[model samples]
Target: MPTPKPSILIQLDSDPQPSVFDGVVAVDSGVEHLFRHGGVQPDAVRDLVYGALFTRGPADLQRTAIFVGGSNVAVGEAILKEVTKTFFANFRVSVLFDANGCNTTAAAAVLAALEGAGGVLNGVSTAVLAGTGPVGQRVARLFGRLGARVALGSRQLDRAQATVEMLGQVNGGRFTPFSTSDEDSLANGLAGVQVVVAAGAAGVTLLPEQVRRSLPDLKVAIDLNAVPPLGIEGISATDKGIDRGGVRAWGALGVGGTKMKIHKRALQELFTANDIVLDAEEILELGRTTLG
Candidate 1:
């Protein structure tokens, strides 16, 4: 009888820390050992990842895959590309990227909104607060692909415009730009919007309580901020798929349970096949299977 293959997880950090492994371990499985590093620059990650693949042996290396995530999505993207390019040169391992949990979490949040909204994300006018960030972009893309007119909001008009342009290139859908630095701007963006999502930084209030409460056409509201100060004013962290004022609300942690479940399932799904990119769109479809 052959010995079972040992699975390992390599965590590369731009800023090295021992605690970084905890974040990945909390949600993933089959990881026999976890390798962590900090202060890993783009130029060095290729060699680092390559070394891990070769040293793990073919069986272990075949089971080996890389997941890139960090506070900075750009940094995460750079590292992810390097790792993938290097691995493709000599190895057949898979790679996944989701900086700040943006891709996966955004997929989950939007799927929840679609579920709470009763079917298609099509023809819906949606506004995303703090829409310049990584998670926000993924949400906007997913919304656009599903047929929604998206208002990508940011404090800077340039950032909002950039996001709109990017989404057009990738998904080829109509997107509006909004600057939500003041109450009037936020309200203007939210006007006639059916779905609103707050995916800003932690503990920072972007959407006011009054705005969430007053929107008549708003059918679904989601907040992806888990820290002390909520992102969407009236939505509580505990409000998962809860209905309020004719609109359904979901908080960071509230939407997180479904995100975690989807993440785990996504990993298992990877092992069952050879070439699959489980980005926002695919992840949302997986979540839809369970929605009532």
Candidate 2:
């Protein structure tokens, strides 16, 4: 038998320290050699990508891949764009962008919400709290793509509208902006919605226990905050599938296991082909396969 090709993953991070979460997942996904670079700016991507391209021939290029990650999705997206610019025909490596694990996390949360809402997302009204944030925006987009009538909520109405507009432009789905700065507004925004997801910042409570329990049409609620206070009140970090006030509820750790599985599966898929680019839609499809 010929010698086995080496499996190498180049991790490019925008932060000063590479993400420990991403590093651990890469190793768990069967990457034998991980080359990590921190504080990687968009300007420096070409040289770094060139290094990976030149070292491997076409047949073995599949063994190498790139992962772009950072705390900021915008910066990570820019880096991903620059990385793609360096690739040409027959000389490209598979790449994935998970900045702050937003893509996988969002995909998993949406999947969990759908599961809680009785396995169908089409025509279901859903509200995403903190919709201007990276994960919230992704969740909104994914839900809209699946035919859910998505209301992207933010503390600032302008921000929510901007995100809704952006998602509409890219995903061509039904998305509306809702101001959720206060309980009255949040209640109004969530009115008649079947699913509510709190993807807000750490330690901030987007939905109070009483408010969540009072939503008449709410069938499922998911909180993606693992920090203190939590995103959705009365939900613990480890809650997988629990019923609260007649609504199915899931906490951060509940959705986290699926996210981790999706991330690992996406990484493994990179080695199956040399041209796979696992972004939000591709990663979400991988998550869907896991459900079946």
Candidate that would win on lDDT: 2
For residues 168-224, what per-residue lDDT tens digits would candidate 2 score against the true structure? 998885998999889999888888999999999999999998788778999898999
Instruction: Please list the residue runs of candidate 2 whose C-alpha ends up more than 4 Å from where it truly belongs after superposition.
Output: none
TM-score, one value per model: 0.89, 0.98
Residue 196, model 2: Cα distance from true site in angstroms: 0.6
Show the lowest summed lDDT stretch of 10 residues, model 1.
Answer: 18-27
* Highest TM-score model number: 2
Off by over 4 Å in 1: 18-28, 56-60, 273-277, 289-292
Give one digit per residue, the lDDT tens place, for model 1 in 57-114: 5554645555566677788788877876675544546555666677779988898778
